[model samples]
Target: MNHLKVLALSAGALTLVPGLALAHGSMRPSHGGVVQMSGEIMVELVTKPKALEIYVTEEDEPIPAADFDGTLIVTAPGGAKTRSALKAVSGNKFVSSGRPGSGSKVVVSLIEKKSSAKTFASFTMK
Candidate 1:
């Protein structure tokens, strides 16, 4: 009887692996972080590093930025816009170097070379 219960519990735990993998960082009201995913665009608005990270995901949830050669158009404070390119960071993540000021809005526009789809994320610092 004990062995049967153990097996059932193990099976249940295994079933949650895929579900957990599919779910990325969640933006809860308690943590003051918001993770927005719409279609293939995922945006994580964070004020810590004074930066905003925009992630482009494929239909299979794989980050497309790894092999994506794109341009990032960033709009800074006082309505100043600058264009920068993206580089791969190790695994499936891309990083952009910028320091945003407090209470300033960041606008990121991503344009992939191989595709015509454009993803955008705008975050305001607090």
Candidate 2:
């Protein structure tokens, strides 16, 4: 009976292994960055030279960064506030020319529109 009990436990654990390995696709941010869920919208942030490149995800899957709209918010080294606009620079990326000194955080707000539905995501400068 003890051997049978051990066998059952092992089988149960094996059945649950696949559930632990599921990977959620798409990109997300690290520290000082967050994803907010709004009415049919998502807010995301991504890093730029001195700007924040924001991309809105209209679908559940990750969309190329080149097609995203960029909004950059910079908190200057001296605690001043500045802003810049981001434009698509290349494949899967957006960029800005605003020079936010070191230690400035770039907040990107992107919006995505899909067949009558919209979503969004945000990324921070890294």
Among the numbered candidates, top TM-score falls to 1
TM-scores for the candidates: 0.54, 0.47
lDDT scores for all predictions?
0.57, 0.52
Query: Which stretches in model 1 have alpha-carbon errors above 4 Å?
Result: 1-33, 45-52, 58-60, 70-72
Give the per-residue lDDT digits (tens) of candidate 1, residues 1-126.
Answer: 999999999999998777645544443322245555655556544444744444544443546565566455655567776767655664445566665666566555565556766667666655
Which whole-number lDDT from 0 to 100 does residue 40 have in model 2?
42
Least accurate stretch of 10 residues (summed lDDT) in model 2?
113-122
TM-score of candidate 2 to 2 decimals: 0.47
**Model 2 regions more than 4 Å off:** 1-10, 16-19, 22-62, 115-126
Query: RMSD in angstroms, all models?
Result: 9.0, 7.0
lDDT per residue, candidate 2, 18-82, as tens digits?
66554343335432335554444344554445544444443344456555455566665577777
